[model samples]
Structure formats: structure tokens, C-alpha cells
Target: MDIDLKELNLDELKSLQKQVVKAIGDFEQRKRDEALNAAKAIASEHGYNLEDLMGDGPTKKSKSKAAPKYAHRENPALSWTGRGRKPAWVIEHLESGKSLDELLIK
Candidate 1:
């Protein structure tokens, strides 16, 4: 469609800008829905359910901290998850000829 842009004033231009933005958003949603529906139809024809075909599957990984696998015998508050490098106290204890097994939290 051909239109005269120069004839429109500021208010009309602003309104047209909003309409264009809304139209673009609506167009994108329509296209996404169309593609998803087509994919679901094809999956069903192949005897697969939609979730079996395209779902992300599984909940996100938990954020909870792992149980402390090691701790200082002298200070129960000092602990380590046993994942990263050994802490300074742990290193010193090991250097003193005491086995790491002795520092196990359990």
C-alpha cells in the first residue's frame, strides 16, 4: 500500500508508530503458533505425542547446596563440599600427617 508520510502530523505519526509496533508483535505470535501447530500435526502422524516430540523435558537443576563432605574438627563451622580445591585448614591438617578421612563430616 502506498501512503503519504509527510502529510501526517506528530500525533498521527505517534499513533501510527504504536499501531506498527503492535502489528509486528501480533505477526510474530501468529507465525510462532502456526509453526508449532504444524510441527505438532507432523509429530502426531508419526505416532509421537507433542511433548515426546518437542518438549524441553525435566525440571531445572536444583539450587540447593550439597551436604558438607568435610569439616574442621576444631571448628565445626568450617566446612567444605569436597568439590573444589582443598581449603587452607584442610591442607595444613593433611600436611601434618593426618589423613583427610579423619576430617570427613560424618
Candidate 2:
């Protein structure tokens, strides 16, 4: 479509620009949706889902919750898996000249 930019006022130009940006974004999204749908259909035909074929998709496997390796001496409810940064309780225990082995969930 031919559009004479020189003929359009400032407001009209701004409106046109907004419309063009929206149209471009919508076009890209539509293309992605179409491609995904097509891929899903193809995967279905092969007795598999799009996620099953693409292991990194929305239905990808997630790491199971790690079991707690240690628990609070006073309150057994407070526990840690010994994975990431130590919790306040664990830090406090260590600060009080206590060993991490003391917190081990026997």
C-alpha cells in the first residue's frame, strides 16, 4: 500500500507509526503461533507431542525437590538440603561454634 508520509500531519504520522509497530509485532506473533501449531501437528502424526519431541518445551522435565539433609536441633521443622546458601538457623548454629555435622538429620 502506498502512503504519502509528506501529506500526513504529525498526529496522523504518529498514529500510523503506532499502527505499523503493532502490525509488525502481531505479524511476528502469528508466524510463531502458526509454526508451533504446524510442528505440533507433525509431531502428533508421529505419535508424539511437540513437548515430547522438544525436550526443552513447556512440559520439560523439572528437578525433583531435594530431600532435607539437615534439621534444626530445637525445631526439626526447619531443614535444609545442603544445596545452596545456608539458612539463618544454620548460619547461627555455625556461628555458635557448632559443627554442620551436629545439624545432620540422623
Candidate 3:
């Protein structure tokens, strides 16, 4: 239902404000209950015990001591070689008159 603010008296405006506040509170409570029920249902179907469901703490980082491979690999493209300042390898190849297009894989 559409209401014109210009047509409502002071009492009607106050009553309308109260009704809107109550509706918002009721909708929020319903949303909370629905989410709780869905989570419980998922836990039951997945065979997770109550403690297992409750213990979903913060995610931990990988503890492997070895550094990842390809950490030392140079970028294939020359896009980020710094503005007008090429890396040593690129300068060497360019000084030898090698075509930039041939150096780029793409």
C-alpha cells in the first residue's frame, strides 16, 4: 500500500513509523532462525558431530618449509621491466640486435 506523506497527520505518521520498525525486527528474527536451521541440517547430513561443527576456527596457513618452485623464474613478458629501463638480460639481447618480437613468446 502506498501512503502519501503529505496526507498523513502527525498521529498517523507516528503509527506508521512504529509499524515499520516492528516489521523490520520480525523479518530479521525470521532470517536468523532460517540460517540456524540450515546450518544444523547441513551438519547432520555431513555426519559432523556437534563439536566438529562448532570448531570451524580461522584457517591456518600452509606449514611446509620448502619455498615454492618458479619463485626465481623471470617474467615471460617485458611489460613490467620498468619504464625505459630494461633488465640486464634484455639489454644484452637488444644490444646483440635481436628482434623484440622474437624474444616475446607471444
Candidate 4:
């Protein structure tokens, strides 16, 4: 684990620094993933998903699933959950002067 940094030239030092940064980032990711997997195993043993414990992880955000709000007229199967971004079909219909009410599932 001991590095003779004194023998390293400026360019070599810079390259080593970059490598060190990348190694640190990779190590951190591995550690986080390992810890998460361990936590998930413990949670599963207790009959709960990791998400159930963290409520969508360390961020503690929860998203309730919403019913579909928009349906493609030509293709009924094509639908949008209306949670995040609007779908292209919805945008197209809107641009073509169709109202959201027109595509309502009701």
C-alpha cells in the first residue's frame, strides 16, 4: 500500500493522482453496492423489500403508482402513466389541437 511518490515525476504524479481518484470512486461504489446488498439480504430475511425499508432508498422518496391518464387514439394499448414526462403521442395530439380530455380514459 506504500507508494514512493518522491520518485514520481510531475506527469507521473498527475497520472497517479487520476488513477487514485478513479480507484477511490470505484472503491466507494463497490462499498455502497456491497452494503446495499447486505442490507437487502437482511430486509428480505425480515420479509420486506429494501425499498419498503428506505422508502425508495436513502432519498426516502415514495412514488404512488397512478392510473393511466392518456391513451393513444389509434392505438389504445399505447398509454402514459401521467407521472413524469408526457409521451410523444400525447404531445402530438396536443399540438394537433386535441385536448387532454379527448384522450381521457373515461
Models 1 onward score TM values of 0.53, 0.52, 0.47, 0.49
Residue range 14-64, candidate 4, lDDT tens digits: 999999999999999999999999999999999989896777755645977
Please give the RMSD to the true structure for each candidate, in Å.
7.8, 7.6, 9.5, 11.5
How many residue pairs in model 4 have overlapping backbones?
A: 0
Model 2 lDDT per residue over 1-106, tens place:
8989999999999999999999999999999999999999999999988886778666646889999999999999999999999999999999999999999988
lDDT by residue for model 1 (12-78), tens: 9999999999999999999999999998899889998787555564446778988999999989999
Q: Tell me the whole-model lDDT of each prediction, alpha carbons only.
A: 0.90, 0.94, 0.66, 0.89
Can you give the lDDT of residue 11 in candidate 3? Answer: 98
Model 3 misplaced regions, further than 4 Å: 49-52, 55-106
The Cα error of candidate 3 at residue 50, in Å, is 5.1
- Which one wins on lDDT? 2
Please rank every candidate by lDDT, starting with the best: 2, 1, 4, 3
At residue 67, give the lDDT of candidate 3.
28
Which runs in model 2 stand beyond 4 Å of their true positions?
56-106
Q: Count of backbone clashes for each model? A: 0, 0, 0, 0
Q: Residue 106's C-alpha lDDT in candidate 2?
A: 89
Worst 10 residues of 1 by lDDT: 52-61
